[model samples]
Target chain A: MNDVIKLLTSHRSVRKFEARELPEGLLETLIKAGQAAATSSHIQAYSVIRVKNPSSLEKLVELTGGQPYVASCSEFLVFCADMKRPLEAAARTGEDVVSGMTEQLLVATVDVSLMAQNVVIAAESEGLGICYIGGIRNNPQAVSELLELPKHVYPVFGMCIGYPAHEPDIKPRLPVDAVLKVDSYRDDETQVAAFDSTMHAYYQSRKGGNKDANWSQNLTPLFNQKLRPHMRDFLIEKGFTMK
Target chain B: MNDVIKLLTSHRSVRKFEARELPEGLLETLIKAGQAAATSSHIQAYSVIRVKNPSSLEKLVELTGGQPYVASCSEFLVFCADMKRPLEAAARTGEDVVSGMTEQLLVATVDVSLMAQNVVIAAESEGLGICYIGGIRNNPQAVSELLELPKHVYPVFGMCIGYPAHEPDIKPRLPVDAVLKVDSYRDDETQVAAFDSTMHAYYQSRKGGNKDANWSQNLTPLFNQKLRPHMRDFLIEKGFTMK
Candidate 1:
């Protein structure tokens, strides 16, 4: 296999990082490479905020429920799905632009995601370790205020990039049959049951303290509890009114 | 630059493809690479449907408003944001899982986007061209019925993969400063104005037929008129109620 394929296949979300910053201009180069990702109709509805202030970083750490890596990483970026750019551009041309729609939100979210994944691949290629911080959504409104995000912009997720302080094992995934269907969607209960056991073994064997839970058991809280239910209202307030 | 960086930065969406099928096992390998992507809470909430039948392909082409490449590509797969697997797994364990929430929708959408982009990177490494057809959202319901997608599973987007018959120039993006901010959000009016001219030149001189529109002007239709406003109600009908 080629180097790119190997790098793509062997991705692990590194949570620990060495206290080393990237080389000069490396982050800029990475972002430019990220812009190379495919955008729907070239709308490119995404923006990334580099969190540099110590106070803001500390606040975010607490806000993300004490994820210390948010502050410890050499570089932390909050990726935001932004429709304001297009709205402003259209408005400048005297077009009465629609600011909020479900399709617009989906497009912006997909756009940010495609760009962030590209950034992750590029970072991994440079011997850098990276992790995606979805916890940013755990407190989206506060994050929006902290990052000074304007209307039509919402922080989708945060990313940590730095030198790896530890080499975490690549976590196993659902078997290929479970995810990649031939022509139609089929139930994969058998595969899911098998994967639960595989994940159980992985948790017990990994370097981190043994977690006595399988994949299904681990997902109980996320499914049982109302997970960040305020997201709909939050998105509406941020100008993704879904009109 | 390394090969990975070069491959990523040189990405161009190829809508024209040669009539050649991928080698057996390459698509599977690519999907495996995609599964390696980090998922939220180990919930790999996604499914991929490979459309091979000529009749289904023809229907998808018409549904996506005559994207001819959708039919001519060597392989076409629809990346689905799926919550059915997780909910079923939780249900089997006798947990009363929450059926629909805004957070679930975001997680599944982000999960599929991450996986599909990895598949794209893997395909590119193997010298295949890929295009993401967001136009599938234009007729999501019809596409879903054609693919036999059950509730809690919706096609997020369709992807076309094959060898490029003709190389297309890499599309230029907004200036990095416009998207990447330090510490906080910043207004990018000047950047947007400058990029409009850049895009104007690109459209007038590109390999495709000359178009008389700038980037802002091009976005007028999407913002001025409601583009695919039916998505919200449709998502609700498809079990992503976002309640």
Candidate 2:
């Protein structure tokens, strides 16, 4: 396989990073790449906090569901879905700033995700390995407090990036036919059940796989019970209206 | 600047691509990288369609707000926020699929965005240039018919990727101070205005020192009135109950 193809096909999350500091302008360059991503309406409703302070990193690591990866990485960043700057822009220019709604929240959230991926890509190209800490959402209040995040700007996720100390095996994915459709959407139970077996095998190959190999079983708890339960309310409290 | 950093920082939308075919396994690698992105509830609620047929490309270009760029690139993909898979999964197994609503739509949309960004990054790392075609949303219904997309699966955007034929300057972004904040989200008018000026200068420079320069003037119409006016309706039509 081509080198780039190999890199993409076999990407693994890096949990350990070298303690060495990153080279200069790396953060700026990453942010630039992120900002270059396509935004809905060019709103660019996102921001990144470059957390280089070790004490702050410690606090963040704790807040991020006690994930040690947050502290171990040389560079940590929190991507924020920000609407405050645009609101401020409208305020100064005496323009209407009415998008404090749920729709706006969704747009900003999507926008931040797009930008954050760009950051990940840029970091990877620089020979850096990064892991996303979705655990950051486990305690959103604390994250907001630590980051001094104001209303209409919420932490979407945390990313830890640095030179890799250890390389993990590439995680397997559902087959192309399982996810890719030519025209319209189609679903076959047999295909999913078959894919479930494949996923189970993938898990068995790893020392620590999901508790249950069944994709549905693993997914039930995530959506049926937890995840984004109060995100809308949280956004509302933070200054977004779900209108 | 490092080669990787240069790639990240200097990325520009390349509407024109070399007719050269992608290397073997590259497409699969790109799709895998996309799948590895974080999915809400691990539902992986998205699908990608790789268009190789010229007639299909022409049809898409016509449907995508008549953007010639969509037809010009070597690889064209329409990213879909797909809920049909899990919905069907539940139906086949007689499980309740209760959450395929507005919130679910948000999850799928964000999920697809992150995945698409991963593909972009992966492609760029392999010396590919990409342009996101948001105009696909302009006439979602027509595009849907052309692509034979089904209910509950809507195309979020179209992406064209391949080798570049032009080297455009990196677009400027709002200042970090204006966008980034600590701990609570803060809105600062003066900072935003200054950044807007920076944007104006960047645009002016791009326009070869043209007279008009304010960023707001260039963007306000799109967000305030056009492009997004009926997107909510489009979502509803896709069988997403935005409750």
Candidate 3:
């Protein structure tokens, strides 16, 4: 494989960091690389907030369900899906802007995600380890208020970037046959069953091995309960009414 | 910049492609690279459908707002946000799975976008070009029916990948100061106005210099109309009730 493809395939999330800040200009270079991702209709509907304050970082750690990496990492960034700029920009052209269509939410969310993925890849290429803190959404309102986000913008997720303090094995993904299909959707129950065994073995043989859970059991918490049920109302209050 | 960072920042969407097929195994390698992206709780809630049949390609071209490259590209992939697999796996463990919630929708959508971005980067690194066809959402119902997608699964976007038939200039993004913030949200009117001038010059000097528009003006159509108003109801029918 080529260097880029190799880097792409070797990704593993790093939650433990060495507490060393990045070089002065590297973060800006990474953000510029992020801006190069293709956006929907050229609507660059995303903004990233870099959190360097110790008190704010501590609050964010509590807000994100006690992910200490949020505070311990060299740099913490919250990626927000932002429509405020686009809406105002369009309004300047003398158009009666439609604000809360569901498609707007989808477009902005996807735009920010594509941009953030580019940032992740760029950071990894630079030898910085990173972790995506989806827990930011567990308390979206507090995160929004904390970042002083305006209307038509919401925090999608947060990312922690720094030098790695731990080396976790790359988690194996689902078999290629399970995710890829020809022309139509198909069930991959057999592949999934086989993968359960692989994951079970992985959990038992990793660096610290006292776990006895398979993939299916690991997914129980996410499915058995309503997750972030307030997201709909929060998004609506933030101007993505899903009309 | 290093080679990877240089590649990341030099991306351009290529709509015209040479009428040639990918080598036998390259597509799978690209998908493997895509699978390396991090997932929320390792849910891996996504799938990809590769459409090669001419009839299906024609139908997709129409479904995606007549993007002829859908049929002309060597490979056309439909990236799907899929909760069905994870939900079913969790249910098999004897937990009563909550079928749909707003967070589930967000997670699946974000998961698929990250994976697809990895695929895009891998393709570009291999001397291939790609274009993201967001038009797939224009008639999502028809596209889903064409792909026979099940409930709890929805197509997020389509991608056209192949050798480039023509090179296009990389489109400039908004000024960096406009998107990256420090600690708190801030308005970027000054930087945006400066970017307008940069884009205006770019539009005038580009190879085909007949177009006269700035970035703000280009976003008018997306906001002036209720674009894809059916998406909310469509997603609801697909079992993503945004609960």
Candidate 4:
């Protein structure tokens, strides 16, 4: 396989990082590569905030529910789905533009995601390790306040990038039968059951430490408890009114 | 620079494709590579439907506002943000799982976008061209019914991947200053103004033909009208009640 495919398939979320910082100008080049990813009609409905201040980094580490990688990584960035820029640009053109809509929220969200994935691939190509911090949503309000993010903008996720301190085994995934369906959706009971067995073995044999949970067993907490109930109200207040 | 970075920076959306099928097993390998991308909390809230039927391809071509590439490409796939699978799996394990919440919608949307971007990068690495069809949301209901998509499963976008018949110029993007900020958010008026001039020249001298418009000018119609207003009600009906 080519380097690109090989780099992609052997990917793992890197949490531990060496103390060394990224080489000069690498972060700039990585962000440029991210801008090359496709945007919806060139709207570029996204913005990234690089947290370089040590105090702000510590605050973010706390905001993300104690993910220390936020403080230790060579660089940490919060990717925000930003419709404000395009809306303001369109308004400057003297068109009667609206502020927020449900579709606008979706477009900005997807646009940011596509751009961020390119950033991930570019970082990986440069021999860097990365971890996505979805736990940012655990305290989106506090992070938003700390970042001074304005209206019509919301932080979707965060990323920690640095040189790897350790190489962890790539986690097992659901079989293709469970994800890639042909022509129509099908029940995945068989595929899901089989994957649980695979994951059960993976947890026990993984490098970090042994855990006794499988796929479905691990998902119990996420589903049983309310998962971040404040998100809807937070999005509305941020001008994602979902009209 | 490595081949991966070069390939990524030079990516262009190929509308015209050579009428040849992919090498055997290439598609499966590409999907596997896509699966390796990071998912939020292992929710893996996404599904891909391979659209091979000629009539459905033609219909999708029409559905995407006469984007003929949908019909002409060697392969077409619809990437859906699916919460149904995981929710059902959690339910079968005797957990009282809630179906539709605002956070659920956002997670699924981000999940599917990340997975689909990997698919795009994988396809491009193997010398294929790809275009994402956001117009699928224009008439999402009809398309969803045709694909037999159930509740909590909605198509985010469609992709056409194949060998390029023509290599178009890589369209210019907004400057990095406009997209990336440090410590806090900043207004991008200056960068946007500069980018508008850049896009003006790009539109006037492009390969296909000269067009009289810039970036902000082009966004007028999108913001001036209630773009995709039907999406709000459709998502609600499809079990993405962003409550």
Chain A vs. native, model 2, TM-score = 0.91
> Ten-residue segment with the worst summed lDDT in candidate 4 chain A?
A217-226
Instruction: Give the residue spans of candidate 1 off by over 4 A.
Output: none
Off by more than 4 A, model 4: none
Index of the highest-lDDT prediction: 3
- Compared with the true structure, all predictions reach lDDT values of 0.92, 0.72, 0.94, 0.90
Worst 10 residues of 2 chain B by lDDT: B219-228
| Model 4 CA lDDT for position B98 | 78
Error of 4 at B44 (Å): 0.8
Per-candidate TM equals 0.99, 0.84, 0.99, 0.98
Residue B66 of model 4 has an lDDT of 93
**Where is model 3 more than 4 Å wrong at Cα?**
none
Docking class of 3: high
The candidate, 2 or 4, that scores higher on TM-score is 4
- Selected candidate, larger TM-score, 3 vs 4: 3
lDDT string for model 3 (B114-182, tens) is 999999999999999999999999999999999999999999999999999998998999988899999
Candidate 4 lDDT by residue in tens digits, A55-110? 99999988899999999999999999999889988988998998678899999999
- The RMSD of every model to the true structure, in order and in angstroms, is 0.9, 3.6, 0.8, 1.0
lDDT of 3 by residue, A114-167 (tens): 999999999999999999999999899999898899999999999999999999
The lowest-lDDT stretch of 10 consecutive residues in candidate 4 chain B is: B1-10
Extract clashing residue pairs from model 3. none
Compared to the true structure, candidate 1 yields what TM-score? 0.99
TM-score, model 2 to reference: 0.84
